[model samples]
Target: MQLHDSMIKEIEKSKDKIIENRRLIHQYPEVGWTEIKTAALVARELESLGFKVSKGDVVISSKARMGVPNQYILDQHYAETLALGYSEAELQPFKDGFTGVVGEMKFGEGPTIALRFDMDAIGLEESLSTGRGPVDKGFVSQIKGQMHGCGHDGHTAIGLGVAESIAKVRHQLNKGSIKLIFQPAEEGVRGAKSMVEAGVLQGVDYVLACHIMANEPFGKLICGANGFMATAKMDVRFKGKAAHAGATPNEGNHAILAACSAVLNLHAIPRHSAGETRINVGTIVAGTDRNVIPDEARLKIETRGANTAINAYVKDYAYQVIKHAGLMHQVETEIEVVGEAVGGKSDEQLIDIIGSVAKRLNVFDEIVASDDHAGGSEDFTYMMSAVQAQGGKAAFFMVGASPDGTGGIGHHTSNFDFKEDALVESIKLFTGIVLSLL
Candidate 1:
């Protein structure tokens, strides 16, 4: 209890700094794989606190990364970050879009614990309404079409706070090591797999991660997350010969027709009796001119299920439909998988630890073990799986962010924002959990 109280004091002292950092990150939002500046900031803060820091390809495997932007896009982000006054030395490690940071500390030989934090913003314009949180607070996103619609900015701040608090109380901890994983590109569920492949969870004995839920009431904490659906994001393209629609329509193979057919058939995929299932064709693009038969078409699609096997069942059936759709239209079909994640359940041991700590803090008004329904996909499942594979226990927890105890704005919307005070509670909870384990 003495050690926990000490950690709480450290977190309380840094409350103002944590809120400032969250607002600062909210101002200059960056999207997945393009978070060069964000990664640098996290790395610098960890270094200042005396943690061994690693960045770039060393923290994330280049070959294993999926849905990465092309070189041109990555170069533009690098240039933009360089112009923002970050030294070439600080920005060089993340030059080619490999952006993530890992801060490590060694104590002796006990349990190795890791905490994961994601750093990326959603692509959305911010609302300029006067009463909106960001607008009223004067920290609205500066970049157009990029905003911290999700609470990752707050998560990053909490992670840094935990690092600072841990450094201050290292002597009171058990003989173990701590790792702070600042990940990128989690919005598309694309980053965690790469980090896991690069050996992030190699020797981990326990791993814990938390997300800020905008809908839940503030001071409410969920000990573990469940019903995470496994999912896959894919890009489908069709190629055909073009010709004048009015003159030689028969000579042209219609790629647009194939894409349309594929969309219909993809949705027609039967649901698995095993559990829930979902499929959506989010975007479709085809044709240059209306007078010409379109020669190319592209689609952005995704599939989800209650678990990995069920997700694969739907994905495989969708593939068959895509192939047949192309054949029906005499067009060539191409498919690329960009992102994927498997469903996972939190370990009961970790859940109990978090629950006990939350009770000790006496801050949370409510504590739940897990969600009732299957929630959306999270790449963190990959990290959880990796640790569990090596006999380590893992759990994904949730902290409420609703300011007025009413569900705030929903995530991924332009008006999305959360209670600033929630940041302090989150830091305290995370810090307490880490100290208890160490």
Candidate 2:
């Protein structure tokens, strides 16, 4: 189905306004759960567009006593709370807090459709040089040490623009509901699960999401793509006896050595013949003193695959390695599962709808299918799982944002940037999806 010519023209007319919102959001970047300023701005804009909004708070509570023995108790309590399903409101009293907001546009009511956009930015310094186009135009991020290097600013702006445009035509929309979700903490891949548990997708018939691609050139958009990788995040800790390196070199169990062994072994996880798999030890900390055999060591590791079975196998093998390394080193070991994201496959039916809209809008020279999956993961898997669990279908698409006229630097990099024109194109795509699905 095609959008009315008037609606297309209206979207075109608001292109400048949408770009302005994108620039404003880019100027003041907020990271993860600490998105107060960003959330406030988004809520204000969403309210102005005549959408009812809901705000959610982080759920961390309980205080740590300042002392020796009590410190361990406090730390354990904190970790346990995180492990359990704590409400977002329960975490608000903590030093660093998280917040979530949802906007809704209710129309004639058929199948409920939802569109999600992440609102958090990464911690990266933006380039001050004029070499990045539009910098001289004052469209650069103003915040220091924090910038929308991940294109989330554009995503949020596009979501808001689509919400506004859709609200204007609510009377014409057939029987269905549309929800705009501006989720937080997507950087750490921690937001969507909690939101899903909170019933964010409850009563929703279909769900859609998109990430702006800094690789696709201007006027080009991708519809069907299996892009995000399945991911498993694990925290491994090894406990042993601490002793002086010189005086009691042989007295300690060498937890640090055990940690090192596990890290290396994890990286050596064999490749899967079925699909692409990767393992990495992102962070490791052990030994407090140069001359001491540390009693405890911690390693943050992640594994990814193109599909679910490989992801599961990689994770199991990694756990076995960690377990055996601790046993061999004679140190107590504990593995905590931090996060997991399953791979995503674009729905062929949804892809067809997107292609049809693109053809009708003449937005792309060719609507090619994409099979490249990024090693990065998204918590949207939680929502996708919930939808499929309830006999519903979902898919996420990539909108081109490459500003170099070709794919630019990878996402989350300090120099990551995208073509500004892609923002309006994304808005159009989202609008079309809502119309067709509803």
Which ranges of candidate 1 are over 4 A from the true structure? 1-3
Highest TM-score among the candidates is held by which one?
1
| Predicted structure 1, TM vs. truth | 0.98
Instruction: Score candidate 2 by TM-score against the native.
Output: 0.87
lDDT of 1 at 289: 100
Candidate 2 wrong stretches, greater than 4 Å? 57-96, 370-375
What global local distance difference test value does model 1 have? Answer: 0.90
- Expressed as tens digits, the lDDT of each residue in 33-116 for candidate 1 is 999888999999999998999889998998889899899999998998899798999999998878989999998888899999
Residue-pair clashes per prediction, in order, are: 0, 14
Per-residue lDDT of model 2, residues 1-438, tens digit only: 347778888988998888888888888787665565566667777888888877654321112110112345334434444454554344333223335678887777478888888888888888877667538667777767888988899888888889878988887866778888888767767567767777778887788888888866666667765757788877789998988899988888999989988988888889999988989898898888899988999998888887777889999999999999999889999987666777777677877888888787777665765556555678777677777678777877777777887775678777777877887777777887778777
